[model samples]
Target: MKRVIYGLFNRLRFKHKLFLSYLLVIFIPIMVLGVYSYKQSEQMLNMQAIQGIEKNVDTISESIDGSVERYNHTIQSIVYNKTFQKIVTNDYLDLVNLSYDLKEYLTPYLNMMVMLDKEIDQVTFYTQTYVPEYGDSVLSAARVENEQWYKDAMNKTGSQWFFEDGLFVVSKFPRFFADKATNLVYMRVNDDSLFKNVTDLAKDYSVAIADEQGRVIYSNQSASKNTLDADALIRMNEGALMVGGAESFLVKKAVRQTGWTIYCIVPAVQVSPNVGSIINATLIIIGACMLGVLIIIWIFSKTMIRRIYSLNVWMKRVEIGDLRMRIRSDSKDEIGELTNRFGTMLIRLNELIDELYRNKIVQKEAEFKALQWQMNPHFLYNTLSFINWKALKSEAYDISHIVTTLSKFYRTGLNRGDNIIPVRDELEHIKSYIEIIQIMKDYSFDVTYEIDEAVFDYTTINFILQPLAENAIKHGINRKTTGRGMLRIKAKLGDRTVEFTVEDNGEGMPPETAKTIMQNQCSGYGLKNVNERLQLRFGSDYSIAVESIAGSCTLMKIIIPQNIQS
Candidate 1:
C-alpha cells in the first residue's frame, strides 16, 4: 500500500505537488489547533459555570446564617433578662398579679424581640412553671407540647432548627437561670422572608435547601422526579451531581449555624450554552480563515509555479541553442528576478554570437587585405636594396645610405604584412623614414626621439608612427621659410594607453586647418587613413589630435591602447 501511494505521488506534476505540500504544511496544523482551541474553550466555559454556581451558593449560605444569628441573639437577650426570669419563676398572688407582671416584663420584651428581627413571626416560651396564654406574639405551653418539635426541643442542649410546618429556632434558657426556669425559648421565624434573598440570589438555577439526610426542606422551583444522591452530593461538595443519568453542576455549601446545606443545581445544558456558542462561532471563523488561506495559496502557488514552468520551457529552448526565447515578468519577487536574469542572459548570449560572427568576417577581410599588400612591400624592399648596393659600389656613400634607409623604412612599414607590431619596430620605421627624407634634401630638420624603454615592448598598429612623422615633415617642416627645422618624436606609456607625439618647429597651419585635418575634412589621406585604421582595429577610443600655432609649431598626437599581442 505504501509503495502504491509512493508510486502515485511520484507521478504527480510539480503544481499538484506544490499544492499538496501547501495543504499539508498550512492546513493540517490549523485544523489541529482549531480542535484544541475548541476543547480548551469548552473547558474554560465549564469552569466559569462551576465558579458562578459556588459563588451563588456561598451568598445564600451567608444570608441564611445572618438571619439565623439575629434570631439567636434575641433569644440570648431573653434568656439573660432578670425581669423575664422573675416573670417565669416568681409565684403570682392571683390572675391580676400575673397580668401586671406580663404587661410590665414579657410584653415589652416580646415587642422588642419582634422589632429586632422582622423574620420572627411569633415568640413563645415553654416551661414547667409558667403557661403563657395564646396571643399575637405568644404561644401556650399545652398547645406546643403536643407537637414533636416541643419534645425534640426538650432533649436538645443548645440552639436547634425545626422546619416542618414553619421555620422554628429553639434554644434552652441559660444555665444561670436553669434552676429557676426549666424553659425553652422558641421563635417561629418567617420562612418565606428568611429564604427570599437566597431565592433571588440564584434565580438562574434551581436552589434547594436540604437537611443532613438530604431531604428537600425548601426549593425555589417545583420538585422534579430527579432524585439526588445525597451522600454523593455531600461528598462531592462543590462538584458534579448526577440526576436521572444526567450530570449537573452542584454547589453544596454547609450553613454552619444550621445543619443544612444550600444546594445550587445547574443543568448541563445551561452550563454549556457559552461553550456551544463559542464552538460554533470559532468553527465558522476557522472555516472562513481556512478557505481564505487556501484561496491565497492557490493564487500564490499558481503565480509562482507558472513562472517556474515558463523558465523551464525557455531553458529547454536555450538547451537547443535557441537564444531568442525570453521570459518577461513584472513581479519584483525572487521569481521575477530569475525571469529577468534569464532574459538578460539570452540577450547577452545573442549579442556575443553576433559579435563572434562579425569578428570572423573581419578577420577574413584583414587576411585578404594583408595578402594584397604582402608582395608590394617585399618587392619594393628588394629593389631598394639592389639600388643601395649599386650606389655603394660606385662610391656614392650618401646616395647609398639614402637607398638603405628607404629600404629599411618600406620593410618595417609593411611589418611582414602584420597589423600589430612592437612599438620599437614602429619607432625604427619612423627613424628610417626621417633619414630618407633628410637625404632627399640639402638641409633637413633635426629629428630627436624621447621614447620610454618600457613602451618599446608594447604593440600598436604597424606604420602608425611613420604616417604622423611624414605628416609633420611634408606639411609643416618642408614648408618652413628657413627650410631647416626641428622635429621631436616622443613615445611614452600611461596607465592604460600609449602616446606618440610628432612636433615640428617649422611653418604651422591655421587652427581651423589643423582641426579640419584631424576631422578628416582636409586633403590628408595619410592622416585620415591612419586614424580610420586605428579606430577600425581597436575601437573609437584610440584617436589622433593635431595642435598647431600658425607659423610657429605643429604637434600631431596619437593615442592608442597599449597591449601585448598574443
Candidate 2:
C-alpha cells in the first residue's frame, strides 16, 4: 500500500504534488485543531454557566440577609422605645385621654418608623389591655391570639420572622412591664422588596428561599405540584439536581442573618445552548481554511510554472545566439530575480562586444588628434619667434618686445599639452600676456601683482589667469572714465588652499552681467572656458566666481587646492 501511494504521488505534476502536500500539512491539522477547540470551548462555557448560577444564588442570599437584618433592627428599636411603653402601659381614665395619648405619642411614633424605612410596609402594635381599636397601627391582641405566628412570637424571646401571606417580623415589647398583658410589635414588609433580585433571573432558573425546617418560604417560580424539593436542595448544598425529571444545575447560598438557604436551579441545557453553533462554526472554518489552502497552492504553482517557462524560453533564445532579446518582471521572488539576471547577462554581453570594437577605433582617433595638436602649438611659437627676430633687425624695439611677450605667453599656456602647471608658471603666463597688452595699449592702465611668495609652490590648471587679465583690460579697465584704469592681480596662500583675485578700476559691468557672465555665449569663451577647466580638473570647490559693482570695480576670484600634484 505504501509503495502504491508513493508511486501515485510521484506520477502527479508539480502543482498536484504541492496541493497534496498542503492538504497533509495544513488542511488536516486545521480540522484536528478545530475539533479540539470546539471541545475545549464547550467545557469552558459549561463551567462559566455553573459559576454564573452560583453568583446569582449568592446575590439573592445577600439581598435577603440585608432585608432581614433591617427588619430585626427596626423591631428592636420599637420594642425599646420609652414612649411606646408609656402609651401602651398607661392607665387611661377616659376615651378622650386615651385618644389624646394615642394621637400625641403612639400614633406619631409608629408613623415615623414607617416613614423612615421605605421597605417597612406597616407597623402594628397588638395589646391585650382594654384599649379600643385605633386603626391598624394599634390593633387588639385578641384578633391575632389564635394566629400561629403570634403564638410563636409570644413563645420566643426576641424577634421572629414569619413568612405567611407576606413577610413580617414579630417581637414582644416592654420587658420591664411584667404584668401579664400581652404586648407585641409586628412589622410587615412588601413581598416584592425581598424577592426583587430573584425575579430578574432567567425564567428557566428557579430560586427558592428555604427556612431552617427546609420549607419553601419564598420562590420566584410558581408553586407547582411537582416543584423541586427544597429540603433535598438544602441537604445536598450544591451540584446537580432533578427538576420535573430533567437534570438541572443547583446552587445554594446561606443567608447568615436568617438561618435560611437560597436555592438557584438552572436547566443543564440552558447552560451551554450554543454548543451546536460552536461545532457548526468550527466545521465551517475548517472548510474555509481547506478551500483557501487549495486556492493558494493552485495560484502559487500556476504563477511559478509560468515564470519558469518564460525564463526557459528566454534562455533558449540566448542559446541560439540571439543577444538582443529583452524581458522584465516586477515580482520580487526568486524566479523573478533569476529572470532579471538572465536578461542582464544578455544585455551586458551585447554591450561588451560593441565596446570592444568601438574602443579600438577611439584609440586610433585619439592618437591622430594628439599628433595634430602637438604640431600646431610648436609651429605657431616658431612663427612668433621669427616675427620677433625680424622686428629686432628692423630696430622696431616695441614691436619686438610685444612679439617676444606673445611668444612667451603661448609657450607657457601650452605647457607641453599638460593641464596642470605650477602656480609660478601660471603667473608667468598671465604676466607675459599682460605685458603684451600694456605695450599695445601704450601703458594706459597700471598693473599691480600682489602675489604671495608661498603660493608659487602649489599647482593649478594652466592658462586660467591669462584670459581673466585679458577680459579685465578689454572690458573693465578700457571702459573706466573718471579715474586711471588700475588692474590688480593678487595671490594669497591659506592653510589648505590658494586664492587669486583679478580686480579692475574700469567701468564695471552690471550686477546681472557679472552674475551670468560664465553662462552667456556673448560673454565670449575666455571666462567660461577657464571656469569649466578649473571645475572639471578640481571639482566645483576650485572654480572661478565673479563679483562686480557697476561703474566702480569688478573682482574675479579663483580658488584652488594648494596640495595638488604638478
Candidate 3:
C-alpha cells in the first residue's frame, strides 16, 4: 500500500504536489495547535528582548573602553618621545636653533601622531616659559592658567579625562621631567567618535554615559521628554524603572578604562505586544489558513521555477564557448548544489589554461639555456685576465684596469647559472658597471653608496641592480647640462623586508611618463623585466616603485621579503 501511494503522488503535477504537501503538513497542524503556541511565544519574546538589550549595552561599553585605551596609548607615546622631551625641556639662548628644532622635529612628530590615530582631533602643548608660538600646536600657559580644567591637570600626577564644549579632552604631566611638571599635554578626542555607538541605538531606546561622580557626559535623548537620569540608573543597576509614570527596562555597564558608566533604557510595552490582541488575531489567522496555504504554494512553485530557469540559461551560455559565465543561489536544495558544481567546473578549466601558459614559459627558458651553453664563459674570462696582465706589463694602466673590471662584471653576472645570489655580489656587480661608466663619460657624474652593513646578509635575484644602475646613467645623469650629476644607491633593513633605492639628481620626466614607464616598452626593457621577475619570484605584492619630479630627481625603489629563500 505504501508503494502504491508513493506512485500515485509521483504522478501528480508539480503545483498539485506542493498544494497537497502544504495542506496535509502545515495547515491542519497549525489550525489545531497555533493558539497555545502563540500564547507561549509572547513570554519567550519578552525574555529575549531583555537579554538582547543587556547584550547591546555591554557591547557599547566595550567599544567605548577600546576607544579610550587607544587614546591613552597615543598620549603616552607623545609624552615619551625623545624629540618632544627635548623641545619642551631645552633652555634656549638663541632663537635660531629653537626655530630650526621646531621646524625639523616637533612639527613632523606631531603631524605623524595625528595621522596615525584618526580619533585625535588636535594635540596642543602648553609651556610656562616664554617661547614664540608656531601654530595651534604650541601656546603660552597664560592662555589656560585660569581655567579649571587646566589647573586640575597641573596638580594631577596622572592622566585625567574631561568633557568641554562637546569634546573629550585628555590631560597629563610628563612624569619623567620633574622641573617641567607645570607643562601640560592636551589631546582632544573627536566628539562624534566617542558617542558613535550610543547614537546607533534604536529611537525608542535611550543611552547615557556618565562620570564616576554621576555627571552626565553624553545623552542620546537629551532633547526628548523621555531622557533617563544618570544617577537614578546607576543606583538601580539592572531592573525596571518608572519614568513619567510608565515602567521601562534599564541596564547599565561600566567602562573599564575610564571610570564611567553606560545606561540604557527602553519602554516595557515595546518588548511584547498585548497578549489578548495576539490571541484574537490568531483566531482570524486560522480561518484564513487554507487560502494562505494555497498562496504560499503558488509563490514557492514560481520561485523554484525561476531559479531552475536561471540555471538552464547559464548552462546554455557555457555550451556556446562562454566558460566565464556563472550563477549563484543561496538555496540548500538540489538545484543549488548543481549550480555550485558548475561553478567548480569553470574554475578547473581556467586553472588548466594557466598551467599550459606556464609550461610554454618553461620551454622557452630551456631553449635559452641551450644557447648559453654554446659560448664558453670560462675561456672568455681567462682571455680577459691574460690581456689585463699584458697591458699592466706594458705600463698601460687604464686599459689594464678596464679589462680587470670587465672580467669582474661578467663573473658576477653569470654567477654559475644561479638565479639567486648574496646581496653583496649584486652590489659588487653594480660597482663594476659604475666604474666602466665613469671611465667612458670622463668622470662627469659622482656616485655614492650609503648601504647599511646589515643588508649584506640577505639574498636577492642576480643581475637586478646592474640594469637599474645602467638606466640611471643612460637616462638620468647623461641628460644633465649643468653641474655634475649625482647618483646615490642605498640599501637598508626594513620591517620583515629589505629596501633598495637608486636615486639620481638630473633631468627627470613628467608624472604621467613616470607612471607608465614600467609598462611602456619604449621607456626601457630593463625596468619592465625587473618588475616582472620580482613579481613572478615573490608575488604580486613585491614590485618596483618609481618616483620622479621634472627637472629635479628620479628614484626607483625595490622592496622584497628579507626571509626569502633561493
Candidate 4:
C-alpha cells in the first residue's frame, strides 16, 4: 500500500494539480451561474410572454363581449321590432324589404363598434334569408346553403361565437352568422393585427410558443434554437397553460401567460469554454517555473558536490603523505572558504616537510664528514717510529728513501682542508707506505706505474687509492711463496671512462674471497668508505670492483670519467 501510494503521488504532476485547482476556482462558478441563469432566463422570458399574451387576449375578449352585446341588441331589435313584425305579418311588404330596413338601421352602429374593437378586421351582416338589399353596396351575398350556421339557424336561431385561425375577409359579401344561424341576423369579427402585435412584443423575450406536445409554434430568439425533451419541458410548466420547455440552456426564462418555452440557450459547453486553454497556460507557466527551479538546484548541487569531492581528494593526498596537495575553488560559498583554508594548511604542511628534509640532508652531510675524519694520524706516527729504529740499525741508503717517502705520504694524506687530491699524489702516498714496510721487513718487491699523462690532472678524494694499495702489498706480498713480487698501477682510457687497475702477484685469495670483497662492502669500513665517497662525489656509475684468482693475484679496478676535472 505504501508503494502504491508513492507511485500515485509521483505520477501526479505539480502542474496537473495546479491546473486542477484553477479549474475548480473558475469553472465551478461558471457551472453554477450557468445553471442558475438558464433557469431564470427561461422562466423570465416565458412568464413575460405569457403575461403579455394574457393581457392582449383579455382585452380582445372584453372588446368581443361588448361588441357581442351590442350586436345582440341590434339583432333583438330586428327580431322583435313592431315594424319587422308588421311587415312579416302583413305579407304585403316582402322579407326583402324588412332585410333592407334592418341593414340600413344597423350600418352606422356596426361601423362604430367595428372601429372601437382593435382586433376587428371589418364588419359584416347576415339575415335569415338571402337579400341583396341587406348587403353592403360594394358586395353581393355569398350564400352558405350548407354551412353549420345555416343549418343550425334554419332549425333554431340565437347568438353564438367560436374562433378559427387563418380567417380572411371575402371580396363579395361573406355571410355573418351565430355559431349556427341562417334564419337570424349575423355579424363577422376578426383580429388581423393580433399576430403583428404579439410578434412585436415577443422581440424582448427569449420566448417561444410551443404546442401542448412541445412543438415550436414561434420563437422570440431563434439564434439559440433549443429543443426540449418532454420531461425537461415539464420543469417549466406550472398549470395547463403555463410556460414550459427548457432542456439545455445557459440562461432561461418563462412566460407566465402562454405555455411557450423561452430559452436563452447559451450553449452548455460555452458556459466554461476556454477553461482548458487557461489551464494549459497555467501549466506552462508553472512548468517553466519548476524547470527553472530544478536547473538552479542542479547547478548548485553540482557545484557543492564538486567542491566536496575536490576537498576529499585533497584530504586523501594529505593522508598519503603528499603535503603538496591542495584544494582549489572559486565559489563564494562555505565550500570555497573551506578550500581556501585547506590550501593554507597544505602550505604549512609542505613547509614542515621541507624543513625536515633539509635537516635530514644536513645531518647526513655532517655524518659523512665525520666518517671521512675517522682516518687518524697517530697510528701512522707510531708505526713510523718503529720504521725509524729499524732503518738506523741497517744504515742502508734505502732507509733515507723510506723516511723521505714517509714525509711525502703524510703530506698527501692530510691534504689540508681539501677532500679531493690529484691521483699522482695518492700514488706517492702508497709508495711511501710500501717503502717503510720494505725497510722494516726487508720484503723484496718491484713497483711500477702505468698511467696516462693526461689522466694525471684528474682529482679524487684524498687517501682513497693509497690504503687499498697498502692492503695489497703488506698482506698479499709476504703471504705468497718466496719469490719476486710486482706492484703495478695502471691507468688507461676505456671508452668514455678511465680504468685504474692495481694488479699484484701474491698469494691471492680464492674467487670466493674476491667475491666477499666485492659484495661484502661493509667488511672493511675504509674500503667501503672509499668506494662510497668516490661514488657519491662522482656518481654511482663511477665506482670500484675487486677480481682475484687462487695463487696468482688480486686486481682492484677503479673507474672514473676520462675527462674528470675537480
Candidate 5:
C-alpha cells in the first residue's frame, strides 16, 4: 500500500507546477517591469514640468537682458550728448561745470545713475580723472584690489556710467561693471540701484540680478537675499552654463538667448494615482487568469488522481506475483495508454514464466534418468564382483546378501523404466551402492543420514543420491590422502523439499573443476547426467553443487523439491 502511494506522487504532472509557480513568477516580473516603465514615465513627466519652469526662467532672464540692452542704448545717448564736448577734449577740466549738463543727459536712464553717484554699500565704479570731485577716495577694497577700471578709466576724457567689482555677478582683480561708465565731468557711480527689471515675467518664480562683482544688485525678495547659488555664478563665469536642483537655479542661457535648469517638483502622491491605477489593473488581470487556471488544474488533478489510483490497484497484484492479472482500460488518454501497455507486458511475462515451468520438468527428468543409470551400471559391476568374491571366499556361501542388495539397487535405479520414484525408494538405492563401494574399497565413506520422515512419503525422481555418492567415491576419496573421509545425505520437509550432501576427505578437485564437472555437458556421464536430469524435473533453480579445495575434501549438495518432481 505504501509503495503504490509513492508511485503516484512520483508521476505528478510538470505543467501543474509551472502553472502555480507563474503566480509568483508573473508578479515578480510585473513589479520589475512596472518599476522600470514607471521610472520612464516619471522621467518624462519631470522633464515636462522642468521644461515649463525653464520657459518661465528664460522669459525673466530675457527681461533682465532687455534692461541691460536698454541701459546700453541709454548710455549711448549720454555719450553722444552735446553737453559732454568739453569732457571729450583738452578743455576736459571744464567738466566740473558739465556735471549739471551731464545730469540732464543721464535723465532717461538716470534713476539708477544718480543713485550710483552716491556712495552705497558694497558697490564700486569708475569715471574720468577730470571729474575728480568725488575725490581719489578710491581705496583698494578688502575684497577687490588693483582694479583696471579705476586705473585705466581715470585716464579717459569720456563721460559714461557703469558698475565695477565689489560684490556683484562677476569678479576679478580688475573690477569691470556690466553697464555704463563715468567720464571726466563725473564722480563715481557705485550703487546697488544700477540694474532693474524691465518686464513682469516670472511672477511664479523668484528672481534676482547681480552686477559684475556677483553681488545681487536687485531682487524680488528682501535685501541681502539671493535666489541663485553664489557658487552657480562662479560656475557660470567659468563657462559651465546654467545649474539647478531642488533648491536653486541660475538662468544662464536659452531660447537661442536665455536658458536655465529648474526643478518644478510636485508631491509624489499626486502622480502616483494615475500610474498606480495602471499597475493595479495589470496585477488584477494576472491574478484573475491565475485563479482561472488554478480552478482548471484542481478539477483536472482530481480526475487524474482517480485514473492513477485505478492503475495503482491493478499493479498491486502484479508486484505480488499474480502475473496473469491485467488492468482493463478503454480510455485513450495517457493513463489508459499506460494501462494497455502494462497488460500486454503482463501477458508476455506470464507466458515466459509458464514456459520456464514446463522446461523445468523436462530438464529434471533427463537429469534423474542419467543419475539413475549412473548408479545401475556401477552397482551391477560392483555386485558382480561382490558375488565373485564370495564364490572365491567359499563355494557354498549363500547368495542372498548379494542378490538382495542387487535387487534393491536395481529396483530403485530402474522404476519400471520410468524416471520418477518415491523418496524412500531412491534413498534405498543409494545405500546399496554405498555398501558395495565400501566392500570393494575397504574404506568407510562415513555416512550420516537425516530426514523429515514425512518427506519419505513424497515422490522424487529416482536415483537422486547415487550419482552424488559416486562423485564422492571417485573425486572425494583422493582429496584427503591421509584420512578415511565422510559422506552425508539428508532430506527435510520445507516449503519445498530440502535435500543435502554426501561429502568425503579425498583428493578434492579444484572449485572450478568441481563446478564444471557438475554443470557442463563436457564432463560425460555421472555428474553431468545427474545435473541435467534434476533441472529437467525441478527447475534451473534446483540442482547439485560441489564445494571443494585441492588438498582438503569435497561436499556434494543436492537440492530436490518433493512437490516439483515429474
Candidate 6:
C-alpha cells in the first residue's frame, strides 16, 4: 500500500504537489481555526461589542476635551497678547484713531485664529466702546450685554462652553484690560465639525450628548431624547447600561474636561451581524495571505531549481575531464560563493594536469638522450682529438685550450641525462666554460672559486651555475677596459637552502640595469633563463638577486632549496 501511494505521488506534477501541500499545511488549519472561533466567539459577541463601543465613546470624549482645551489655549493667547493689551489701554491715541487702529491691529490675530482651527466658524471680540460694529467678528459691548451667551460668559470667572443654535460657544474675558474695558473673545464651534471623527459610529446607532441636568446638548437622531432610564443609569457600572427593551444596548463615557456624558444606544441585534461578518472577513484574509505566500514560494523554488540544474550539468562535464565549464551566478549568496570556489578548483586542477603531461614528455626525452650518449662516447673523444691535433700543428695554443675545455664541458653537462646533478659536477661545468672564456679573452681577468665541500654532495639544477658565471663575465668584467678585472665565485650550505654568489671587481652596472635582468627586459638571456628555471623547479620562493654600485663592484646571488638524495 505504501509503494502504491509513493508511485501515485511520483506521477503527480511538481506544481500540483506543491498546491496540495499548501492546502493541507496552510488552508486546512485556517479553516479549522475559523470555524472554532466563529462558534466560540458568537456567545461573547455582545459583551465584546459593548466593550468596543465603550472604547470608541471614550475616544470621542478625549477628542471633545482636546477641542475644548485648544479653544481655551486660543483664548489665553489673546488675553495675554501684549499688542492687544497695550492698544486697548493706550490713552495716547484720540477716539477716532483708537477705534480705527484697534480694528486694523486685530486683523492679523483674527486671520491667524481662522487658519489654525477649521472648526471655529466665527470669532468675535466685544469691548466697552461706543462703536456699534466694526465687522462680523467685532462688536460693541452694549449690543451683546442682553444676550444669554454674554451673560453666561460674564457670570463665570474664566473660560466657559455654551451650546446655542446647534453650535458650541467658547467664551472668555481678557483680564488684562477687563478692569477698564469689558473685553470678551468668543470662539464658536460648528456642530457638524465637532462630531466629525465619530460619524461612522453614529450611523446605525442613536448617539447623544447630555449635560449634567439631563438636557440633551447634541444628538445624531432627532426624535431620540437625551433622557435615558434614570434608574438604569444610576444602577449601571462605568462601561455599560441596559435599556428597557431586550434589543437595546447602551454604552456611555463621561467628559472629564466638562461635566457632560456621551452615550451610544445600539441595538443588540447589530452585535450578531458583526460576528458573522468578522468570521467571513477572517476567512477571506487567511485565503488571501495563503495565496500570497504560495506565489512567493513558487517563484523562489523555481529560481533555486534552475540554479541546481545548471550546477548539475557542469558537474557532469567535469566528470569527463572537461574542466572549462562553469556556472553563471550573479548572486552573492552561499551558492554563488560555492560556484566561485568550484571555478577556482577547476583552474588549479587544469594547471596540475598540464604540469604532469609536460613532465611525462621530459622523462621520455631524457631517456632518449641517455641512449644517444651511450653510443657517442668514442666518436666524441675522436672529434676532440682531431681538433686538438690541428690546433697544435697550427701553433695556436688558444685553439687547443678551447677544444679541450669544450670536451670537458659537454661531458660534465650531460650528467648521464639526469636533470639534477651534484654541486661538484655543476662546479666542474662552470670551470670548463670559464677556461674557454679565459682563452677567448686572452686572460684579461682572474677567476677564483671558494666552495664548501659539505655542499658539493648536495644536488642542484644542471647548468644553473654556468649562466650566472657567464653573466658576471659578460656584463660585469668585460665592461671594464682599463683595470684588471677579478671574478670570485662562492658556494655555501645554509639552513635549508644552498647559496651561490658571483662577484666582480670591475665597472659595475646601474640599479636600473640590474633590475632588467630579472624583469627579462635586458638582452642578458643567460641570467633571465637561470632565474626562470630556478623558480619553475622550486616555486617563486627561490630567485636571483643582483646588487651593484656604479663604477665599483657587481654581485649575483642564487638561492635554491636543498633536496637531499639517497
Error of 3 at 411 (Å): 0.4
For model 4, how does the per-residue alpha-carbon lDDT over 1-566 read when each residue is reduced to its tens digit?
99997797678866545544554455555546545554455445555544554554444334434544554564465556554433223323566665565556556565665677554554444333333444442122245546654454445434443232332222111223421322334445443343344345444333343433455444444432444344555455332321233333323343332323443332222223354544454556555655555555455546556768878888888888777665666778888898898898889878887788667655644665675467666676667667777787788657656766786677676665466667677667776776776677676787788878766767666656765777677657767787898888887777877677888898888877776664455444457666766666667777778888778888888887655565
For 1-566, candidate 2 gives per-residue lDDT tens digits of 99999999899988888777766777668878888877787778789999888777777777777778878887898878876765566565677877887888877777887787777898888888876778997888889899988888888878888777778888898656466686888888887766676677534577777777777877775323347666666666477767778777777788887677777777788887676787887788778887888888787768777778888988888889887888777889898888788878788999997798567555644543464376588689889888988999999988898888888887787777766678988999989988888888888879999999989888886777877898888888887777788999999998688999999988888988888888854443477767766765567677789998888889999988876554
- Quote each prediction's TM-score: 0.41, 0.42, 0.53, 0.35, 0.37, 0.41
Q: Which stretches of candidate 2 lie over 4 Å from their true place?
A: 1-34, 91-98, 112-119, 128-133, 177-182, 202-204, 221-237, 280-566
Candidate 6 lDDT over 359-477, as tens digits, reads 95576456546644765766887899899999999999978979989889888887767778888888899899999889888988999999998887688988778877877888779
Candidate 5, 493-559: lDDT as tens digits: 7776666667777777776787677645644347776676677667789888778878877777877
User: What does candidate 1's lDDT look like per residue over 1-566, in tens digits?
Assistant: 99999999999987787778887788877888888878788778789878878877888899999988877777777767876665555456677777777887688878886796687788877665654563643444566787877887778777888877778888876555346546777778888898889778877786778775566677775223355445545565556766657777776788998899877778887887765698897799689878988897787768766778878988988998787775677989999898898898788889999799679658754764665475677578778888888998899998887887777777777766677788888899989988878877764668888989988778887767777887888888888887578999999988788999999997898988887885663453378777767777777777788899998999989898879755
What number of clashing residue pairs does each candidate have, in the order they appear?
0, 0, 0, 24, 43, 0
Clash pairs detected, candidate 1: none
Models, CA RMSD each: 31.6, 22.2, 15.1, 45.5, 33.9, 19.7
TM-score for predicted model 6 compared with the true structure: 0.41
Q: State each model's CA lDDT, in order.
A: 0.77, 0.79, 0.78, 0.57, 0.55, 0.74
Q: Give the clashing residue pairs of candidate 2, or none.
A: none
Model 3, span 232-345: residue lDDT tens: 656765777777688887777888877888777777887777877678767777767767777887788677788888888888887897876655667789999888887888
How would you order the candidates by lDDT, starting with the best?
Answer: 2, 3, 1, 6, 4, 5
